[model samples]
Target: MTTIALSQEQQLALSNLCTNIQLWAKELGFQQIGISDADLSSETERLQQWLGKGYHGSMQWLEDRKKMRLNPELLHPGTRRIISVRMDYLPEGSQQIAILKSPEKAYVSRYALGRDYHKLMRKRLALIAEKIKQDAQAFIPELEISSRPFVDSAPVLERPIAEKAGLGWIGKHTLIINQHAGSWFFLGEIYTSLPLPVTEVITENKCGDCEACLKVCPTAAFPRPYELDARRCISYLTIENKGEIPEEFRTVMGNRVFGCDDCQAICPWNKYAKPTCEADFQPRHGLENSDLLTLFMWDEQTFLKNTEGSAIRRIGYELWQRNLAVGLGNAPANPDIVSALTSRLPQASELVAKHIQWALVQQKNPNRKRVRKLSRTRV
Candidate 1:
């Protein structure tokens, strides 16, 4: 697409529109919003290096979309700027450390405790995009405008975009961390044709000398600062990996049945993390602090009903059961857990059956020890 030079009047109107969009975004429940130029040349080398290291594991899509991810214009034609927004997702009264310490409790990732964010975020972003289109049309008639909203559903490099838009700096754990807001939030973007003035101020990396996130990982998923080997990551092991739970990481997996939050929880900046006010993000079905056996006992129908409209539903019942079995194995072996595992063994698929049997062995073995100490729990 050819770039059209905007007159002074058109430039002023676009600047005002950008300002209005921020206010509108706030009204739409976004805590922060920023505009960034579409150029992602700086991130290309880093992304290539990360992909080359085989850090993405089974997530081959990340490698597949390398070209589009580097060039926003390719992903969405006529895109000149990216409007980045952040929505805090940490629910109030989260017992992250408490539930993590209690081996009997099933520790679902705080993000998955509530309804899925994709639909909600996409709807909100689309609304913002429409409002932008309306305002742009009103300002300059016949000015071509095109925008596309993206949550995590697309190949968008949301964090890098957010960072360029002055949202936050990328921390050692590779998550965007605001100095004040921390990292307990979700990011979304609207790729737009409008040449809005980009955010001039970029937040510098504030994670100086703090290797807490790296050291606190149960599976030591981080090989170095700003690098993650997702294959060994608990979140990947529990949620992304389709087959059996790898035996190597199970002992250290603890009670986290869905996803792990150790890196975010251990970040010192999270002390300032704000709890989300959105009802959609609040925990559903008492998942905030459920017991291992209670979740493990959930039949396919029960799992389906409970996880409806929740991110956990994407994993399906088999992977859900497989993860719970690992959690049960990590729990202080009780007869109830043993019974739950034993009863499910016959009906489980070959993949899930292996995990169930592993749980049984863990339940029966009195000498099997937890790899990590429980005293490090913090939120």
Candidate 2:
């Protein structure tokens, strides 16, 4: 460790600065903020092993930027510390659970129900970075401070960084979890050149003896704790992976038309999750409880307009329709649903048509159960 002599006055000032950062973080809608050093060799090896098992499916990019993901300095030269922050995204009450069990309503992941988090999180991080700069200039003028905000946009090992920063430990489901905040939060980071004090009290893994997330997988995505088979994950199937929907996992998908939250929902730790106070995070376009066929009927223009600022927009209208077709197919069949699928059949692309035809067949035989159990628990 490089020892930089600090007078008692400066030491006290730095302590107060940390306190101020936490308070400002809360004021800016962040649930928590923690600082960590920039070493992630172990995490890099784990990632390589996971990728080696071909768990990433069509997401080959995960294998591309190894160095940047493992070291913040690779992404931003001179980066010496990472400032991680969390923001809770779960909507109030049991809306997500209720929808998941319904089998008729479309279960969009709670995180995607609001405005796109990337922009919102980056905006807040910018403000926080500005605050830190202003304070540091006044108190620690010798520090060559440089900070940049990031939210799921680069090759940052966010979960590992969060763990080192004392935000939480990586759960079996591969999501970061805090004892106080649970796993219902979005993580962002600020890569800073300043050698900030690291949060020492790292969260100890509490997934002991319990594999609720592994057993709850609708597609058996978890090969083991802290390891995920992305090919079997609903979020990957519905959002990231393009092309045909695999037949084996379709029936278990139920009415989840977008991202899935089965693993997070089943984690017992989430009971302590706090609902977000930010109005920007609340559900929009009635997506929290919309029916499968309802969302399925959105025209291309309407889909674009409604999802203008939402993360769902990144999937494009074609995939949106494709996913909705699958959800409608899995829903309890009815004349209305059949008619809707039939009408769209002529207009859909080959990919959408394939899913639409599948939906029509499902409508023809509503009670036809094909592989009813996706997994023992994780759905």
Candidate 3:
């Protein structure tokens, strides 16, 4: 292989090369691309505070590798610049409000309905990294340093890096949201030795006075505008937290079987959000607007087969059933829904059985309409 010791002229050429790379990235489905230095001290402090509050719940991995998450060089030896890219992932016509309003229907967050984003984003980032490698090879017969691509796999503080790279500012909901593209995007990072010039300006916070995301949370998961209590979060209860979901959150959970999107769905800026061009992100198995009992009836084999490449598969079949059971409990009482609950109760795990029993009680009381209100206490 050829090695290039970049001189003044070569450095200038590399800068121009980076601009071309951004253009190419845009062509290949990235909405925006930015470069930034790997300083994440501010984000590290915020993480520490959030963890100190016990908001991370059982996700002890956040406590591990304190330094590595804040420093890119700790993860990748020669990392100098981080190339951050955003690809919008919102699927079109995912009637969120209608599903949330309908107590009988389940509401899986749009992102999880399709294929898992980790593999898809990593593939694209790898392709981008490969292009950089080829460009370097042509310029300097031997560019010894290599580029490594990352999706949410490592200690990489993706949002802060993206913020510095001018992708978007972290909203009160703690999601990075572009002014034009909104918050419906997947982020990817490429750690490289190549010293790309950092983006001149970071995005200014556009979340001024708008606590819409904070107020719209079904579980009141936010401690304040910027902080989140993950234990109380429905997304955490339904997906990340392995054991039984706390009793308090079940009723308010409504029909959200997988992840909750109440915050994003209510965000006024999301009107600007663009639909994804990637067919991989399109909803599968009619999950975007499925009935609670319909999804609750899927056996383990059917669950595994249907959610083969989906992000929802990570929660496993039991938790899937557990979450759907909660959704079923919150659904308005019906004989069909009751029969479905009764059928699953015998086969369910203790965690799922508890929720099924709750559903049965709800089923027996045919007159009560389950109101959509979150539990005040953290699960």
| Local distance difference test values of all predictions, in order | 0.90, 0.86, 0.85
lDDT of 1 by residue, 95-177 (tens): 89999999999999999989999999999999999999998887667669999999998889888899989999989898999
lDDT of 2 at 200: 69
Model 2 pairs in collision: 215-377, 216-377, 216-378, 217-377, 217-378, 218-378, 218-379
List, residue by residue over 1-379, the lDDT tens digit for candidate 2: 2445777888788778778989999888888889988888778678888888999899877889877898778898878789999998887864787898887799999999889999999988999889888888897787777899999989888988999899989888889989887899999999987667777684789988998888877888886777888898889999997898898888888888888888888889988999988787889999998988888899999999999899999999999999989888888768999999999999899999999998888879946985645654542
lDDT of 3: 0.85
Model 1 misplacement above 4 A = 373-379
Kindly provide the TM-score of model 1 when superposed on the true structure, using C-alpha atoms. 0.97
The residue-level lDDT of candidate 2 at 230 comes to: 87
User: Which sequence of candidate numbers ranks them by lDDT, best first?
Assistant: 1, 2, 3
lDDT of 3 at 284: 91
